[model samples]
Target chain A: MDLIVIIDYGMGNLRSVEKALEKASRQVMVSHNQGDVRAADAIVLPGVGAFGDAMVRLKRLGLDAAIKEEVTAGKPFLGICLGLALLFEESDEHGVHEGLGLLPGRVELLPTNLKIPHIGWNRVSVQKESRLFDGVPNGSFFYFVHSYAVVPKIDSDVLCRTEYGCEFASGVERDNIAAVQFHPEKSSSLGLRMLENFVS
Target chain B: MLSKRIIPCLDVRNGRVVKGIRFLDIRDAGDPVEMASAYDHEGADELVFLDITASHERRQTVVELARRCAEELFIPFTIGGGMRDESDIRKVLKAGADKIAINSAALENPGVIGRCSKRFGAQCIVVAIDAKLVQAEPEKKWEAFVHGGRIATGCDAVQWAIEAAGRGAGEILLTSMDTDGTKQGYDIDLTRAVTTAVNVPVIASGGAGNLDHLVEVVKKANADAVLAASIFHYGTYSIAQAKEHMAAAGIPMRLTK
Candidate 1:
């Protein structure tokens, strides 16, 4: 049985992510404890609130270092929505907020012309062949709701791109780390398949 | 570009999906989980489960139902009704609802909107406005209603929408009480009034008789999303059919093949 630890930094609804992962047939545990996180087979960093606040909570709880250690150990780590943005170098959500600096990127507002919070299902175009989207088809609709997105400094980190106003990096991958701007838990069966792939 | 959404709303009472939800494969039509799963498979962009039962125990039932639906269904869903304060909102979201829609409670205490939006991101807080047309001497306008359209608030519908959005509400679910069960069509004027009043996405609800009515709300009223109950509950038109019709009518929609 794959024991997946969902790191909780006191932001958003963590239960939904736990339930979704459970539905994917994985044993899920949502914990803020560093020890539980270290013992997990896989780690999922799921978030739904402001980037700065989430990072503050992560640092306060010392879970940020634990996450880095787990990822450094070559464990499969997945980030969802704001969790994806947190993996970047920095964000300008309210002010300049430093992130975990896992991926080479920065988070910025979607665009002025586009909806402030790009809420709804949009089609994601898979750019490269990665295990994250093993069975999921290209151009599949995924649920997305966010005002900011990650602008990867390195082009090679971009795995999938979705067009809202302009094409944006919807999914990114680097070795054992994978993250998506869309909420896979809320994105129907294709989303579950993505989680299942992550578990495998 | 973001596409228009077709949302199927399920009215849950005592944890059971109320009204006649006639699906050929569903043995128990009143089951909220079954109804939600059916709608998800039908390609509903989102689902809104409104818990009409306001009792304490019944609210828990709704929360339990939300948890079950969230586990089974993959699409995003909002749980509304009986949401009094931030604590109530937390309970629902903790139960796996992606968003919480407050109607009467918000009218009673407008601060709850700001508090919930601030605590649980503005993107997850939806303020639902039930509006009834008010024909006054010089000009006929709409007024917001509360308590399941039983009490009328003197606040102007459009103005209230603006206030709600200003208070950090991510979206507004506007329903026309006059045409609620009439099966005529959505009040395009009311929808447009609210949509234009608020920069946030407005989900047009009530008075959806056919596919054209759905198209009309998005095309004419400029609603970001269209939510229907009876039209979809009684199987007059499936969500896929509505999406196909909207897609052909020059409305951007997510069509699952």
Candidate 2:
């Protein structure tokens, strides 16, 4: 399949995600329909705003289970920002809300010392090899603006880490599923390169 | 490890990018799409296009410009100015603008922020506050200005910032009309006042003449980002140069790979 489906349930920033994926020379289609996503070569779930709100929308559109199935089929799956956080067990941003449970982790608020909503570009250091970051240079910075993070229960779930007052997972990959806390679309050249790697 | 964001603010008038001194020079810069594409390539973290135009010309030009830039720009870009209603905001967002910033319109309709935040996620909505330090009221509080900084709104700047946050604004873009174009530095008191009052990320705009001014605002005001125009447009400094200075000063920027 030549199409790269960007699952949009009305909560995520879809246009920038589409433009970035297209910049990677991938034919992208932003859709909420599971059937369309199932037909695509790969899938991307880009999110912004509150975790509770995002989960509510995903469930409302019945995309949560669809996404799980898509990843289970062994196609490349990528989550961004809140999309990454929503791949965990639950989040406490506004209240306790269940996540997709695709990975073993819990989304919690970033520590208070380093400022709430870590806004701006942050560097990512690879922790291991993964197709998601294949050609991306080491120590590349990706744009991040979030209030919560995923705390992986198992260390192998972590793919890359970055420090902001405290070190945290910036990128995570397991099998066909990979997610990043930063916005590669908005992260500039290094970010575009990562998108290129993911699509290629 | 957050990198310092270098944002270039484009003041659009009659479908053209323009810059001025205290909003007076009003000279054309170039095509908004071309300029934006250049910034996107030159390492700008994000871009802001303020529709400084006065008529319906904004609709045709801004939309066309946004669509053109979105075709090439891979980073997030915000569009502001002359956005008076939900339809206006919708038009831009549909045209590929990542975020919509409302200033005068938001002040006129207090519910605008809540409405926009609800319709489009809060992260896609930015509330811009243009404040001027009045000499002093009997209450000794600086008042904010609206209507293109032509009229004094008599409201406290900090109070308005808090109200905007309470209304579900995702971020605050505060511009010091008093210090704008002065090239002295940002109004630290004003920047600190609003940022401390609101939990959202505050972009310190206006009066950024040099790299030191940017560092001072980040350090003293606790601002999440800094924005400028003339220095970047005139090529006095590049985004890389400014970030290098900030990095050297121990401001904690994301290092380039």
Candidate 3:
């Protein structure tokens, strides 16, 4: 059985992500322990809070280094919402906090015209091909609820884009590391289909 | 551009769908799971189940309904009502709720929004605001209500929305207490007020009698989605019909050929 470890870290939406992955036929476990993440076949970093707080908890569990190491070993890694923000170079929310730098990017607030949280369903247009969106149709409306978004420094790493007040990277893929600004777990059938694609 | 969403909201009391002109009907609409499936098939963009059940027994029944709905309904569903703590939120989510809507509990403790969002992700935390108009000496003011829109908290509805978003609420479910069952149309001022005040998606609940109401609310109030119950429950409008109406009005919607 290929176990998919969902890093809890006391942040992010763990159950929904776990449920989505479980529905995808992958054995899953929620853990804050670093050892479990390193041993897993794949790792999911799901976060939902401030960048500073998430960084504090990630360091407290010493999972920060362990996660980078897992990605280095070429395991399928997925980050959702705050998890996606934390993988960037840094974020401007609250204060300037350093991110995982796993994908070259900086997290910034969404444009003011389109509203702040960019909540509800938004269409994501694929910018680059990847296994994450295998059978999902183009212009699929995915659930989104965030005040911040990741702007990847390397444009080629971006997998999808969604427009709010302005066009922004909605999903990114760099090697085995893939992250989505929207919550695939909350995206209903379209979201479930995306999760299923990732697991396969 | 993203398609406009068509949401069917179910008022669940004692685990069954109940209709109310301001929560008056105690009769059952149908099995929540079956109703949800029908909506999904009819092209409902999303679904919301408000737990109108006030007591503990009814709360458990709502959870069971959520489990059934989640299993068979492939669409995203949000569950609200009587969620007091993180444990309560967790239990409901575990029972198949994609998101937890906090109202009275949120006003009681703003920390709940931050804590729950931190733990479950902002996407899972929906702060439901029940707003009623207060007759101002000079002008009317929006007041927040709790206990299923029975009591007023004196807090400004617009301010509460900003605060909720700041606290990490992924979405806001705003219902107009005065216009709730009137079917006159949504409180355009109230909906627009909140939509302009916060960054999260504002789901306009309460008055929605016809397709024009949905169109007006989405265009003028800037609501991302419009939630209706009575019209949907009484078979006055189907999901397809509603979307077609919205689409014709120049509102963005996902229409099936």
Candidate 4:
């Protein structure tokens, strides 16, 4: 049950996630192979690139099907940053592109008029009780580096909200699948604790 | 609210941490990895490792250093100093550094900024500018410098920042050489000038003697972050202490409590 596979679709910061996961879990593997992903007890998909490019690579590697299958089978799954956005139905990043559709949402530009990329540390204020934030305090700060955010159609899916110029869903949890737009692996102590919670 | 960042920059030479005063008089602080870990634990939002000895031969050392830091530290860290092109940037990104700050290289070929930004997403490309005030007829203007601040590029600092932003730099690390190491305060006019010109986040570097400097740069100059070395290296102020001071001064910080 300790096996945690961080899906590497030939893009993003996979090593940092793997290194961070190693601290929280006994066994962590960053693999592009669908077989390793399917065999894992839990899945962590970490991303940091464009929406359309990531989806293309995932499908090319045949990981898209594997990820959908594993998560549908009730395996605990987590997505970080772009990985969070990828779970949605579609994205309007450079142009309209389809997503995994695992979650009912659309990835759109942060409605904020302030800045393009909401880069820096921001508070993730909790909305609902979820195991993802078990020991972490409400409004704990996490490192964020993205311009777009997911707008989950289902209100209850959001676990936390972060303020830039406008509030956006920063963290979401739907049953066994939980994801965060912020990089937990890049966040400090409290972030590690949240990762530890997910693995445990 | 997205809290203003406090970043501790480590100027490394041959892989050891050193704080440089006015781009000279380098003093050894400690091992880069150990200091980086301590800063990460102390609540630093991010860390920047600049290899002062940024020769092509020594690039491998920094790459190795990046690999070690990624294995040890959790908070996002940036590797800078002497990255000439996309390949150099790609090597460090592969090794583990979250961002690549290009100063001299970007100045040598301004096109490198857009090229690197395009190849490796703008999120990971940071443009570091060493700016010094040049006395002119109409008014004083800050000009961008290169070759470790020894050579001048005649490029107006504020104008260059605007151009860099247009070219796709994720963040601008603006350092005022005049106020650097003086510790009196940050260059408010210079920082404000560039921050106003650039849409991207600007990190005010060089002059941070006390905690109030951090707040001044943020409030008066509109700096998105403040990068310090000597003060934090000598333990003049810890990250938590800086956060407390900033939070008390009405500047939002990443304080869990």
Candidate 5:
């Protein structure tokens, strides 16, 4: 069985991600231990808090380096919502907070005209063909709840884009690393299919 | 464009769905997990599980139920009722609920919204306001209520919504007590009043009898989402049908195949 270790840094709702992965037919465990992270076939960093707080928690538990090592070694990694933002170079949520720097991007708040949180289901427009969205339809709707979004320096890293007031990168795929601004665990079946594809 | 959402609310009591849902494939209508799965399959944009059984023991039951539902259903679900403080909100969110809705507790201490939103991001905190129209001499105004509409808070509904949003609540669940259970249709005046006052997404609840009622709330009142219980619970119309109706009405909706 492929074990997917969900990084727990005392932030966000990890159980929902674990349950989603379990339902996706993958062996899942939530752990902050570096050893457990290193042993996993895939790693998922799911977060739902301020970028600075999440970074502080990740560093405090020493899981930040573990995640960097695991992802650098070509293990499949997935980030959800705030987790997706953390994969970028930096974020300006509360202040200028440094991120894991796995991808070339910076997280910033959405346009003021759009709802601050952007909380609802929005259609994702697939930008490229990738393993992450193997079976999911091009315009499948996904659940989104965030105020800040990652603006990748390299446009090709964007796998899917969704529109609120302005078009933004909703999902990104760079080699073995995949992340989505939307919460797949809260996005119904098409979301589960995305997780299943990641596990497969 | 952000599509308007249709949420099916399940009132759970004693870990079981209280209102019997009528669906063809559902073997147990009283099971919240089963019913939630059904709603997810039907492409409900979201689900709200309100714990009518607000006892301390039953709160844990609701948590377990939330866990089960989270495992089975993929759509976003909100858990409301019995949420007292930040700890209670944490417990529910940790139990796999995407968001926690606070009603009476919020009225008792409005700062809870700011605290929870600050700690857990505004997206995870929803302020559910139960409002009823007050008969005044010149003009009628909606007043916020508490404890399942048993106690009047005397707070103006519109002002409370604006205050909640300003305090960092991500969304507002506004239910009109007068229109509740009547199925006459949502109080468009009340919904519009709150939606116009708050920048956060407003979920118009109560008095949804037909697809047109849902349409009226979203289009006429500018509700970001429409939440209904008996209409969906009794299977008068499936979520798909409601979405189709909204789509036909030119309200943007995420229609699933």
Candidate 6:
């Protein structure tokens, strides 16, 4: 029995992620305390909000260093939405704000030609094999709601690619680190399947 | 390709699903969580529980509804109705609702759209516009209606939608009062107008009578999503049937089967 800690950085809905993980039949709790992150077998960073605000909160709670430390220790780290974007070195949202620098690249706003938010169920084309999207099909439709997309400097870090106005990294992975721009908890059964894989 | 979403809108009063619902296997049809889970099982892309509860105290029940739905429902769901302030919206979202739709409150003080969107990301804030065609002169003009379409704001619906989006509304839930109960079809002109004008996704609601009507709105009007009440509530058509029909009509849908 593994304890999964869904870091609550005071942003967006976390009950869904907690519920989804609980549905996977695992011990999971939402916490912002660094001790809980240290105690858990695995940590899940799920967020939906602005890049700069998320970073500010993460740093304020002192969970930023705690998160970086855990990820460096090779814990099964899963980032969702803003959690994914925050892994990049920097983001161009609002202004140039530095990120966790956990993964290479910078976050850029989605091309203005298309809808700014890119809100809908879009297809994710898995670029490299990763545990994040284990049973999910190659071109499965996952729910998306965001204005910015992540651009990894290294291609190997890219886990999946989705096309809206252009092909962008929707999911990325390096070692025990994995994150996705889409919300798997709200994306129906296939999404639950992905979360189940994470716990296993 | 992004699949156009098919949402089933449930009008709720006093925390119970209102209106005539006649689903066969559902034990407690009045219970919104059961109804929502049933819809999820039937392949409904997303669910909307519009709280039509008139009283302010009972509004807390909607937050309870969001909590229950969050526990049971695996897919996305939106909670609309009576969210007047930023605190109300935050309460609902914090309760685990994927999105919250603000209607009359947003119309009263359009500034709430910008304030709420800024606090909670735009993705979670949806502005629901109930529009009715009051003028049909040389150029068609639709006015925004409030209080269940009983009152008109004199505000142009199309322009309101544009302003709502500009004010940071992630999605616009446009319901045409003209074709709402008519069951003929969605207001193609009105829906198309808003969908074209807004940079964000426009969910076309109202007039969803039959399977073809569902296809008609998405295909002709280019609605990013379609929300229906009677057509789905009364068991006229299953979500599978509706999605398949729309998909067959050359519309991209979340068709797993």
Tens-digit lDDT track of model 4 for B1-257: 98889899888888877653231122323578877877787788999998877486667887887888888888989998777888888999889898989888887788988888888888888999999999755777999998878999989888888988899999999999999999989999899989888889999998889998899899999999999988887767778889999999998888854
Q: Write the per-residue lDDT of candidate 3 for residues B61-103, one digit (tens) a residue.
A: 7678777776666567898877788888888887877788989
Q: What is the C-alpha local distance difference test score of each model?
A: 0.88, 0.81, 0.83, 0.87, 0.88, 0.88
Arranged by DockQ, best first: 4, 5, 6, 1, 2, 3
DockQ per model, Cα: 0.67, 0.53, 0.27, 0.84, 0.75, 0.75
Q: Determine the backbone clash count of candidate 5.
A: 0
lDDT string, candidate 1, A84-107, tens digits: 999999999999999999988799
Candidate 6 per-residue C-alpha lDDT over B1-257 given as tens digits, one digit per residue, 9 for 90 to 100: 78899999998888789876777788998999888888887888888888878756646888988888899997889998778799888888888898899988998999999998887778888999999887898989999989888888999999999999999998999999888898998999999998889788889988888999888888788888999999888888889999889888899888876
Encode model 2's per-residue lDDT on A1-200: one tens digit a residue: 37899988876447777878887764889898978877889888887777888888988888887888888779888898887998899888777999899888898888658666676677789999877777677787777777788899989989999888888888799888889998888777778788888888
| Chain A TM-score vs. truth, each candidate | 0.97, 0.95, 0.97, 0.98, 0.97, 0.97
Candidate 5 runs further than 4 Å off: B54-59
- Model 6 chain B: weakest 10-residue lDDT segment is B52-61
Q: What would the per-residue lDDT of candidate 2 be over residues B117-233, giving only the tens digit for each residue?
A: 888767778998999887664443557788878888878888998998889888899999988989999989889988888888899999999989999999999888888898888
Candidate 5's residue-wise lDDT over A47-140, tens digit each? 8878999999999888989999989999999999888999999998887999999999899989658677788888999999898888887888
Candidate 3 lDDT by residue in tens digits, A154-178: 9999999998879999999988999
List candidate 1 segments past 4 Å from native.
B54-59, B136-139
Q: In candidate 2, which residue pairs clash? A: A121-B3, B3-B254
For residues A106-188, what per-residue lDDT tens digits would candidate 4 score against the true structure?
Answer: 99999978887888888999999988788888888888989899999999999999988899999899898999999888888
Candidate 3 vs 6: which has more DockQ: 6
Per-residue lDDT of model 1, residues B53-157, tens digit only: 866665677678768877777888898888777887888888888888999888889999998888778888999999998975576699999988889889888
Quality class of the docking in candidate 2, CAPRI style: medium
lDDT (Cα, 0-100) at A121 in candidate 6: 90
